[model samples]
Structures are given as structure tokens and as C-alpha cells.
Target chain A: MLETINLTKQFNGQVAVSGLHLNIEAGEIYCLLGANGAGKTTTINMLLNVFPPSSGDALIGGLSVTENPLETKKRLTYIPENLALYPNLTGAENLRFFCGLSGLQLGVTEIEGHLKKAGLQPEAMHKRVETYSKGMRQKVGVALAIARSSDVLLLDEPTSGLDPAASNDFARLLELMKDRGAAILMATHDLFRAKETGTRIGIMNRGKLMDELVASDISHSDLEQVYLNHMKS
Target chain B: MMSHLFYFEWLQLRKTWSFRLTALIVPVIIGYSLLLGHQRVQDQHAQIQELLESEQTFYDDLAERRRAIELGESEVEHWFQNPGNPLVLAQFGGSGRYVFLSPKPLAALAAGQSDLFPYYGKIALTNRSAMRDNALENPVMQVAGPFDFAFVLVWLIPLFVITIGYDVLSREKEGGTLALLQSQPVSIQKILLMKVLFRFLVISGIVLLSVLVFGFLLGIPIGSQAVIPVLLAIIAYIAFWFALCVLVNWFSDSSAINAITLVGLWVLFVLIIPSLISLFASNQHPVPSRAMWVTDQRGIQQAVNEERHTFFESWKADHPEEVMDGDTPDFYLIWMQRLLTNEVIQDRVDEATERFNSPREQQVGVISKLRPLSPSMLMHHWMQQVAGTDAQRLQSLDGEMREFQKDWKGYFIPRFRQLKYFSAEEISQIPRLDFD
Candidate 1:
């Protein structure tokens, strides 16, 4: 379960994210659609407690991210726009190392199994990450989330630079995490992906939430028109 | 957790070219420096041994000739060569003794100020002065200093610590791994501390192992009590630099910024602060030049020469009974003026010497109190002290010889004033050099 209580963020007297309230249950994917300055990343950063909220709180499984930073961080996984692993380390080594930071001591076979679940080929998992494609790196990030069995997942434009096929594959991974009961919050600019994969879609303009819709209640064209009209307004 | 980190860090660092280069180059430099230091200590020992042998032979020949002359077997070829005269025995060429300081077990660790200050000196009845070594002729030492273990420990090894530790936290931020790392259960402070600690251990281990290995190979006493202080000082010095690196990395986000900041700190603490402290201390307590002191001594000699006659009359008036009843011997008459004039000159010269020495002592005191501001200076002084080669120890020669000179005079000055000639047996009673 993930929740925000009137979470607000400001930078130098400018509001990056205005008062926002969201309640997403387990097994739901809440995709926040916004343009470049829509405060989607700011909201996710607040939840990650990358910086403290100007007012109110971002909570993970009922624990405040700011007050219980390390404790709440233990229950979640974050995938940023470009996931950077140690370029000098093998995919498996990078996995083992980051997993160790979370107190997960996955063995060689277990690490390979998790990579496989995240749709990485067995051969590519042992190679150095400097030789990895962006898609392959994102798969490693997904594998980390699966390995942690994270209670919540926060993704900030994770699939922004991937090809259409890679983006579709990532959409499938999100679906898999959703089916496993992870409450997911993804910030994105893609309306089609939101309609196709998100359980609930919230469109934001500037710093305020413009509308919230069940993914099933909106058609693909209708979602596009709504996102455009909100942008024009 | 430590074991796992050890293996993990090894796996990561083994591929790193910087660490690999450090592993290959640092040992060679350290080992070579130790060998050079050992050779330096050896050369000092050889010179001391040679001087001692010559001194023994000089004394033996003197005693032998005195014995032959007392029995009327050998004739005195020249008045200056007469072994019976106290002046001849105390002041003639090849007659004066030399006092030397032997090397300690840990002397090989640092050359320090020994190469600039003499370790041994000539002790004569008229004047005692320290003899200088040939360090001034060494351009390499003049410019860059000798490649001794102390030089490597104090100056070069900190660069390697910076190499390994400068990027402990900044690399994560630069590589975009920091965000993910922040979301992990571990605090960044713990991770930073551990990384800095690991690198500190690595550099310290390399230095200690290399020094001991080369040290034993060169026959430097690896078992001496002196080794403990040297090793402890090395560890503390390494920790000081690594602590600086960690502090810089605490808020630095770019590897470049951290590198620049750490190197700047090294320059500030190692080079700039010490130079400024020495400059400040010197300005506060300025010593007069050596040439001025020499000129003062010459002036005292002239003044004392003029007053010698008056001083003799004053002494005669005080000790009429001790004055001889008959006409004095030519030897006693000449020796009295020389001895009395020398006594008055020595007193005046001491006053002048204090003027030269007092301000220098004050300068040393000021520097001593300010040494803690720069750890590099602190480490240098610590190495010198532990190795028994510090300026404070070498400069102690002046005071030590001052006492020894008094004892030397006590033995011969009384005999010279009484016009007493030595027999063969009395020659053995002259004071030998035994300083504590």
C-alpha cells in the first residue's frame, strides 16, 4: 500500500508539487501522466524521501518516508529514468552487491533465477554492465525489485528512452509486479501505456492533479484527447 | 560482513588500473628507499669506526714516546714534539681526541637532520668544535631530500591514499547510482566510512609490509623497541590523511571536486602550513648570524689579550702564598699568560655565544608548540625522534662537549699551571671521552 497526505514540495518559493492526496492499494498500478514540469518526479522523489516534503508527508505501507527513511526504504524499490549500475561490474555482480545493501544474500543460482524472471537472458546476466543495452539495464532494475519482493515500487520515467518493443516488455514487467501485489506509482508522459497497463491513471498539469480515472473506464483516443485538453487549459 | 566486504572490494578493486599500478610501484619505491637508508647508516658507522681506530693509535704512540724519553732512550727532535710538556700533549696536532656518537638500531629509518649536523667532533684543550658531514654537496638532498623511508612515508604515501579514497562517495553520485543507493537500507555515512576505512587499511598494509620485508633483508633490527614507535607513527600518519579524504567526501558530489579539494588540503597541511609556521617562528625569535658570533669571539680574544697583565697582578695579590717563591721557569711564565688570557676570553665568548644561542632556542620552542597544526611536520619530527636522528639530539653535541671540555681541562690545566711534567705513568691519567 502507498499513500500521500496532502504532500507538497517547494523550491526557492516556487511550488514544484502542490497539495496531493493519493491512496493506491496493493495490486494497483497508478501511472501519473504529466508534462516536463508536471511535478510527477517531484512527488516520487518526495515518496522516496530524496528530499523532505515542504508540507505534509509521503508514506509507504503506513510509515512516513521522511521520519523512517531507512526503514521505509527497505520496503520499496525505485527505478529512475536511467538506472546506472557499476559499469566495471558484471550484471550479476552489480545485482549481488546492491542486493547485499538491502541484506539479501542471493546466491549465484538465485541471482540468475531473478534475472530470468525479469526477462534477461542467462548469457547477458554475466557480462559487464558497460556492455549492456538500456533495456538490459532496466531489466536488471526490475530483477532487483523482484528480488526484494518490495511492498511498493516507484518508477520515474524508467522507460523514457527504450524502444517500443523494450517499452512493451517493461510494461509486461510492471504487470507482473502488479499481479504480485506491489502498489506501483509510475510517473510518465505516455498516454497509451497508461491506458494499456495502469490500473488507475491520474493526469496532472502544473503541480495540481487534474483528473483521476480507472484505466478500464477510458479508451485510448479518449485518454489522449483528455491529456491534450488538460495541457491546453 | 567485513569478510564479505573484503571479498567484494577485492573483486572490484582488482580490475581497477589505479590500484594495480599502486600495487606494482609502491613496494619498489619503498624498498629502494629503505635500502638507501640502511646504506647511509652503514657509511656513518664505518666513518665512526675508522675515527676511533686512529684515535687509539694516536694515544698509544704518545704514551710509548713518553716512556722512552723518560728513560733517556729517545731525544726530543723539536720543542713542539716534546711529549712531557702538558701543552704539547693537550694542543699539538695529532694529540687531540675526537668524540663520536654511535648509531642506534632504528637509525636506518630516517636520516633527518643528521646529514646537516655533525655526529662527531674534535675535542681539544683550546677549542672544541663539531665536524660537518658532506650533505651540503648533495644536490639531490638539497633539492628533493634523500629517498629515505621517512621521505616516502611522510610525503609520497599520502598521494596513494588520495588515489584510493578520493572517490568513495562522489563516484556513486557521478555515476547515477546514488539515488538507488539512497533507497537502500544502509545509510550513506556507514558506506562512506567503510570505504575510507578499507582503503586506509590497504595503503597502511602495503607500507608496513614492504618496510619490514626490505628492513629485515638489509639487516636493520626488526626486533628493536625502536621499531614500535616508527610503525605506530606510520599508522597514525596514514590515518590522518585518510580522515581528511573522508571529510572532503562527506558533502562532495563530483569526483573531480573531491579530488581537487583533497589535494588542496594535502598541500595546505603538508607544505604551506609548515612553511608559514617556520617563517612566523623565525620572525618572532631571530638568531644572529654565525659570522657575527665568530667576529664577537675574535673581539673578545683581543680585549682579553690587553687585560691579561692586569688580571695576573690581581690574581697575584689574592694568592700570594700559592705564587712561587723563586723566579718562575720560562715554561710556567709563558703558560700563565696564555692560560690566563684564554680564561678571560672564554668567559666573554660564553656571553656572546648565549646571545647567538638564546634566540635560536626560542625559535625551536615556538616551532615545537605550532607543530601540531601540520600533521606532515608532526610526522617528520616524530620519525626523527624515534630514529634518534632529530636536530634536538644532534644539536645536543654542543652542550655535551661543553661538559667534556671542562673535564678535559680539569685534568691538564692544573698540571700546566704548576709547571708539572708528566712521567710515563701519568700520561694514562688523561680524561678519555665518555659521555652519557
Candidate 2:
């Protein structure tokens, strides 16, 4: 489970993320939809403890990210928007290195299995990440989340640069992870994918969560309408 | 976790062509430096051997002449050529021995100031100046300096270190791997440490292996008392460069910036700062010119020659016992007067030499005190000390040789004053120079 209690962030007396409270339970995919400076990335950065909040807290698996960063970090995994990996290392090697950091010692066969489950082609498993496309690099990011087996996954713009087919493949991968009872928070701008994949959604504007909706209660156009309404005001 | 980090760094370095090239080239440079130093040591040894052979021949001829005179086989034409004459024996026999400075066992490693200084002195009844006999070397070659182990360790090794370490962090940050790495559970500081340590180990291993191989090939005793200090100095110098890399990496976020900053620091410490210090020391305590000293010595010699006739007659009147068969006008009086006048001139020469050398000694003293400001200077001093090629050690040896020259002259002055001819047995009993 992941939760934020009135989570807020400020830079030099100006608010970047202010008074945000949310909960993501097991098997839940909460999609945060927002404009460029809407604090979606800031929200995720707080959850990752990239920096401490001004006066709020994020909890991963019931542990405060600020108070018990290492413990909470061990239970969660993060993938930045630009998913940069060691270019000289193969996909499997990158996976092995990151997995080793999380204290998971997986063998070669198990590593390849995680890569396969993340929708990466078996042929690309042994190729260096320098030759990887943006979509291929995202597959390695998904593989890292799977290899760590973390209960909480925080992803920042995971589908921004992918083709429709690759986006759909990534949406299915998230569905598979959700089915495994992992609580996920994904920040993205694609309304269709958000409506299709998220169990619930939050629309953000200028460092505040302006609205929330259940994905099943609204159609894709309806969610887009709600998002635009928040953005306009 | 540490081992996993090291393995990752090792894998990356193994694939880096620049790193591979540096690893290959450093040893070849070291071997070439060792060869050059060995050649220098061999040249010095050959000169010493030649001097010893010439002295031996002189001794053998003198012994043969004394035997002929004892058997009454030939009549000598002139007192100057007769081995029986004390004046001839003192002037031409083994009394004019060559005082050779043999190379230290580990001298081939550093060369140091040995190329600029003389390793031999021709000691006779007159005072010998070590600096005046500077081994007839080409001035241009002296200016270019020798490519020796000290040059490699003090100047070139830092470049190799910078090449290996300058991008240890900045490259990862630039490629975006740093974010991914920081996202992991490990702290970024530990990861950087592991990366730098991995490179340090690789470079240090190569340097140590080169030193050991050269030590064996050049026959330097690796187990001697100087070995540990030399090794410690090398390790300290390597550590200093690595520490500089760490400081540069901390403030830089781009590989190009890190490289430029590190190379700048290398020039400051290795080349610029030491040169500045040397220039400052020389200006603060300037040595007098040797040319002026030579001019003063010549004037003193000319003055003594002008009074030579009166000086001999006064000495003959004072030491009437040494005058034999007054009608013959014994030539021993002339030789005694020459020896006395030469001793007075030697005193004046010693005073001028001291005045000329004081500022140089002061300059060296100032530089030695300032050496810790740059590790390169410290390593240069340490290496020279270890090899026994530094100016201080050579100066001490020269002092000992001067003392021995005095003892040699003292042993024969009384024989000349008593007008005694040396027998073959007596010639063999002359005080021989023993420098170990």
C-alpha cells in the first residue's frame, strides 16, 4: 500500500506541491494526470524521497519515506521519465545490477524470465542498452520493477514517447502487475491509456490535486473533459 | 554489494579502449626509462674503471724504475725523471691518484642530479675541486635531462592516473546512468568510491609490477633498506593524484570539465609550481659565478710563480739539514718551495670555493623545506635520496675525499723535507685512498 498525508513541497516560500492527500491500495493503479508544472513529478519525487517534503509525509508499505527511506525504498521501485541505464551493459546485465542493489540475488535464468515477462523480445535480452530504443529501454525499466518484486511502483511518464502498439503493450504489462496485487502510481498525459489502465484517476493543476474520478464511472472523453476543466480554471 | 559494484566497474573498464591503451603504454614507458638509467650507470662505471687502470699502470712503471735504481743498472739523466728523488715520486708517482665516486647499487633507478655532477676527482698535492671536473658532457644533453624512473614516476604517472580517473563519475552522470544508479538502494557516494577504488587498484598494480620487474633486471636489491622508502614514496604519489581526481569529480558534472580541471591541477603541481619554487629559491639565494673563481685562482698562481726563486732560497736557508753537497744546489729546495706556495694558494682557493658555493647550498636548503607543497618535488627528493645521487650525499663524499688527500700529502711532506729517496719497498707503503 502507498499513501500521502497532506503531502506538500515548497521551494523558497513558493509551493511546488501543496496539501495533497491520497491512498493507493493493493491491486490499484492510480493515474495522475496533469499539465507540465502540475506537480505530478514532484508528487512522485516525494514518494521516492528524492527530497524531503516541506511539511508532509509519504508512506510506502506503511513505512514513512522520510523517516525510513531505506526500508521504504526496499519495498518500492521507481522509473524516471528518461529511464537511463548503463549503455555498455546488456539488458540482462542492467537488470542483474539493479536487482543486486535491492539485495535480490537472481540467477541468469530467472533474470531472463523477468525480461520476458516485461514484454521485451528474447532476442534483445543480450544486446547492449546503447542500441536500445526508447520503447526497448522502457521494457528494461519494467523488467527492473518485476525483478525487485517491490509492492509499490512509482513511474514518471512511462508512456510519453512510445508508439500506440508499444503503449498498449506497456498498459498490458501494468495490468499484469496490478493483477499481482502491487500498488502502482503512474503519472502520464495520455488520457486513453489512463482511462483504459487506471482503476482510479486524479487530475492535478498548479501543484494541487483538483479532482478525482473512478475510471469505470467515466468514458475516455468524459475524463478528458474533466481534465481540461481543471486545467482551464 | 561492494563486490557487485566492483564487478560492474571492472566490466565497463575492460571494454574501454582508452583504459586498455593506457595500461599497455605505461609499462613500455617504464621499461624504456629503466633502460636509459641503466645506460647512464654503465657509462659512469666505465669511466671509473679506466681511471683505475691508468693509475695501476703508473704504479707499475714507478715500481720497475725503483728496482732498476736499487740494482744500479742505469744512471738517471735528470732528477725529475728519477724514481729515487722524493720530489719526482711525490709529483709523478701514485700520489696523483684518481679519487673515483662509484655509483650506488640503486643509482640506475633515479639518475637524479648525477648527470649534472662529476663522479671522479683527480687528487694530487694541489687542492682538487669536484665541481670543476664535471664529466665533459654535452651541455645540450644536460639541459634535456635523462629519461629515468624518477621522471616517469614524478611526471608521467600522474597523466596515466588522470586518464583513468577523470571521468569516473561525470561520464555516468552525463549518460543518465547516475539517476538510475541513485534510484537504487545504495548511496551514490559508495558507488563513486567503488568506481575510483577499482581504477586505483588497476593503476597501482601496473606501476608496482613495472618497478619490481625493473628492479630485478637492473640488479637493484629489492630487499635493501632503501626499497621500502622508495615503494612508500611511489604509493604516496599515486594516492595524491587519485585524491585530486576525487576532489575534481565532486565539483564537476561533465566529463570534459573534469578532464580539463584535472589536467590543469597536474600542471600546477607537477610542472608549474615546482618550477616557480625553483626560480624563487635561485633568485633569493644566488650562487656566485664559477668563472670569477677561476680568474682569482689564476691571479694567485701567477703571483706565487713570480716569487718562486726567492721563496726556494729562503726555504733552503731555513732547512740547511735538507741541503746536501752545497755545490750541487739540491733541487729538493725548489720542490719544497713549490709545495709551500701551492698550499698557500690552495687555502685561497678553498676560501673562494666556499664563498661561491654558499648560496647554492642555501637554495637547496630552501627548496628542500618547500618540497611538501608539491608531491612531485617530494618524490623527486625521496627518490634521489634512496638512490644516493642527491647533492648532499655527493658533497659529503667530496669532503671525505678532501680529508684523504690531506692525509696522502701529509705522509710524504716530511720525506721530501729530509731529502730521502724512496726505495721500492717504501714506495709500496704509501697511503692509498680507500673509499667504501
Candidate 3:
């Protein structure tokens, strides 16, 4: 459902992301593990067509992102590290507004039902997003994906500052989305979450994807060692 | 899709504190300016009404006195006091009609140059001059101008536009919703356009409604089709300012920077460009100072006075019929000499005055040509023109009075020159100042 063929980006002749290839099918969470400036977010941005790729192409559901951005965008949802919604609006309103942009009309009950499924408290759903914690905001982002029934989900460091339980709750939401047949790509520095929640993991260093491994084949400690070694190199 | 964009945009704007403040403040200022404009035009109407009334009374008294004399009810004690005498009817003391420019239907929209030039003037047999009510006073008022609808729309309305639109796109980017919006199917450019257009609609609608409502309450004849051109020009002017805001937003990402840039542009277009254009236009076509015109008028009067005896002798030789052969009143001989000298002086003064005013007319033409550089300036001039309160309209008083003076002289001077007299019944047949 999500693919990149030799995707690369540059800023004033300095490489932000080198030529790279990635593909993730439905019902899988592919986590990109990297240190800061490792070009993980750049990869997600290219796939989202925020800016065109330097040389190669990113495709979603077999449609080229650069060539048909709106067509591909219709099938995806992005939740950045700090997902910013209208601070003056309630979480439910934010969800409804985004859904409206995606051309989906979800009623109040349906919006509430989706928020409930994403583990947002019934009390917080009607409250302004400015009053929401980072973890609670992530739940709203997850609710957007559920309401839209997006085929692809791009997350960039979405759980960096959350408490342990909130991170775990977010992991559970991703798993639920994965089971519902959504291809998820998350960029993170957390090895444990990558090992536990990610169906497959790729460690990146200096704008290059260094290695890929199935989550079940690697222990949390080994994944940490691999990430640390990649960073050192 | 556009409806959805408008609805959401309105919702967001209403929630914003700045927008809420603007919603309340803008209408108040606009309404107040309209009220001031109404009052200004009302004052002009009052002046015209006063002059017309004074003229009617002056003529009625003359007719009554002449009727009594013809009925053999009273004896004429003095020639100067005789009602049937043409010099008495034309020039004794405030005897001629006062001609004035009436206010147009949309006069309440802009005071314009009405306060800087006379709209009414008196026409006598030998002299015509502008009569001022409240024109050309303090220099400060000239710089500040009248507090009218034109000032509000051309100068203050853009501030509201900038306040609302300066951060239309930058807010979304700075708030970090841009990333999420980018992931949506819509382009940011579309969103930017939508936001700017929405702001333009809000500001324009509020101002238009305010002007209409205030104009209605003030009985300003807003129902007249004459207001349509001014209304359309107003909208176009507001759009010009909004377009500038959009242009500023396109290049800047920070709301502060966008606001500063838009304000800088507003200063350039509204305040600086018009001032510079005025300065440049003045340089292109220089008009002599009002002081110079005054000195020239005094010089003409002195030159004409020095040749007054020669001019009277020439007049006596040219028209022998106007001279009484024998037993004429000494008062008649003295008044006839004064009348002939006044006509000669008036002719020379009119020529000098034309020379003085032609450059001023050219200066106004140059300014009009340069108005396109600043939309605010162009819009202000348009509003004034529609209101009949522009510099050209006010300056036209001299010409209108001159024309009316010809008619005044035509009616009374020929009769006075030929020693013709008629009874009170012909008083109504005398020319009355009529303006459509």
C-alpha cells in the first residue's frame, strides 16, 4: 500500500535523504528507526509529497505521489510528532474538520464512536484541543485515521514525549489500525516500541536505510545495539 | 466545496479575538464617518437654501416698492432708492440673484473638496464672486480632510483588511496545521486563496452594509441608482488592498513578518504613493500660489482705477443714446460714470482671472492622470466626483457664476443702459437662479 523507489531529497546541494527504497503492504506496521537528522521524517514528507523527491518517486496504492498527489493523499493520513489541530476547537471538531477536508461526513455519534475506539476519554472528546495532552492529541489523530478508513498512515516521531502507558496505548491503536488493513510507517528513536509494535523494522543512519528485520526475530536489547551501532557508524 | 470553505473560515474568524474586535469597531467608525458626511452635505444644502431665500426677499421688496410708486402711492425721494431704476435693482446692496451648485444624490458619501471651495456665489450686473459658507479655512483641516465615507473606505478600510488578511496563510503554517493540511487532498494555494477571499468578503460586506444602513437613516437618497458606481468602485478598491495582503502572505511565513510587510505596503500604496504622485504631479504642472492671484487681482483693480476717467469718456462717446440730452439728475450722471468704469475694470479682471485659473485646471488634470498609481487616491477621487463634491466641481463655481452674471447683465444692464423702466408686474419676468 506504501512504496518508495530510490526516494531522495537535497537542500542546497546537501543530501537530506539519499536514494532509498521502501515498501510496506497492508496489515503491517513498518517502523523506521533512526537518530536525529537520519532522514526518517524526510522520507515520510516525500511520500506525502510535501515536497517532490529529488530524483526517484514515492507511490501509494500503486499511484505515483508526485504525479497524482491528491489521488494518493485521499488514501492516507499523516500524524506528525506534535500533531497540531485548531487550538480553539474541540478534539471532536478537529476530527470532523479534517474528515470534512477528506470528503467524509461523519455524524456526531460516529465521530464519538471513532474517538472511543481510539481510546480518547469521553470527557476529553468535546474539550478544546489546546487543553489536551500530547498523548490525548495522538488519540485524536488515530481517530482521524479510523474515521477516514485511510489505506496508509504516515507517522513521524508521534510518540517521542509520551508517558510509557500512553506510548503503549498508542502502540495498541497502531496494532488495531494494522489489523484493519492499513499500511503504517512510523519514524521513531524508541527501539523498544519499534520492536514491540512494529511488524517490521528498518534502522537508518546518515540518510541511508542500514538494515531491515522482522520484529519477532529480534529482541529489544539486540534492536537497541543495532540502532546504537548504526548511529555510531 | 466553496460553501464549506466559507463556513469553516467564518467559524474560525469569529472565534479569533482580533476578528471579533474588528467586527465591533469597524462598523462603528464607518457609521460615524457616514454621519459626518451627511452633516457636511446638509450644511451645504442649508447654505444654498439661505441664499435663495435672501434673493427672493430682496426681489419681493423691490417689486412692492415699484408697485406702490406706479400706483401713485409714494413719491421717489432719491434716484438711488428708486425701485424701477436698473442700477438700484442690480447693484445698490445685495440686489442680484445668488447662483449655487446643488448637492448630487450621492453627495452624502464624500465631502471631498466642498469644504475647500465655494459651491454658491452672488451674480451682479458688473461683478460676480464666490460666497463662502465654510470653505478654505484652517490648513490643518485641508491636510486632515473631512471625516467622510470616502476617507473611511479609502484610508481606514484597508487597515481592517490588513488586520484580517495579513496572516491568512501564515497562521496555518505557524500553527503547524500546514503539515496535516498538506496531507489532505486540497492544495495550500487553494486554501490560501479561499482564506484571503473570505476576509475580503467579510470586510467589504460589513462596510457596505454599514454605509447603506447609515445612509438610509440619514435620508441620503441611497435608493438612487447614482450610488451604484460609488459602491462598485468601493468594492474594487477594497479588493485591491486585499490583493496586496495576499501577495504579502505568499512570500512570508511568519505572521509578524507578513503583518509588517502588509502594513509597509499599505503605507506605500495609501499614504506614500499618493503623496509622491501629488508632489510629482505638482512639479509637472505648477500653479501659482493663491497669494499671487490675490496680488494680480489687486494690480488689475489699480490699473483699471487709474484709467477710470478715460474709460468713462470713451463709453459716453460710443453710446450717445444712453446720455440724457438736458435736465438730468446729477445723481444719474455720477452713477452712470461709476457703472461704465466698473464694466471696463470687470472685463480686464475676468481676463486676468482666466489666466490664473487655467494653470489650476491643468494642475487638477495632471493629478487626475496620476490617480491610477494609487487605488485609494483613484477611489477617493471617484467618490468625490459622484458626490459632486470634487475639486473640479467646487472650482466650477467661478465659471457658473460668470455665466449667471452674463444673464444678470443681459436682463438689467441693457434696460439700465437704454433708460428703460417697467412696473412691478414685470418683476417675476426677471431671471431667477435655477439649478437642476
Kept native contacts, fraction for each prediction: 0.71, 0.62, 0.69
Better of 2 and 3 by DockQ: 3
Candidate 1 local accuracy as lDDT?
0.85
Cα error, candidate 1, residue B226 (Å): 4.1
The superposed Cα distance between candidate 2 and the true structure at residue B365, in angstroms, equals 2.7
In Å, residue A155's CA in model 3 sits off its true spot by 0.4
Instruction: Report candidate 3's interface RMSD in Å.
Output: 0.9
Comparing 2 with 3 on lDDT, the higher-scoring candidate is 3
Give candidate 2 misplaced runs (Cα > 4 Å). Answer: B68-77, B84-90, B93-95, B127-144, B309-330
User: Per-residue lDDT for B55 in model 2?
Assistant: 77
How would you order the candidates by lDDT, starting with the best? 3, 1, 2
Off by over 4 Å in 3: A10-14, B136-140, B283-289
Better of 1 and 3 by lDDT: 3
lDDT of 3 by residue, B1-436 (tens): 5676787788678888779878898889888988888887778788778777888888888899899999899889877778888888887787877878898878888889888787787877766878776766778877888788888888888898888888888888899998888899887677667777888999889888887888888898878888787778878888888888777777889999988888888898889999998787678778788898889888988888788888778888997877767776676667677777777778877887788877777777878888888888888888888888888887777878878887787788777766677579787568776675
What RMSD does model 1 have?
3.2
Comparison by TM-score, 2 against 3, better one: 3
Q: Which ten residues in a row have the lowest lDDT in candidate 2 chain A?
A: A69-78
Clashes of 3: 0
Which lDDT tens digits does candidate 1 get at residues B225-336? 7688788888999888888877888788778989999889888988899889999999999988899999998988988888889988887788776577787667676667
DockQ of candidate model 2: 0.69
DockQ-based class of model 3:
medium
**Which residue pairs of candidate 2 clash?**
none
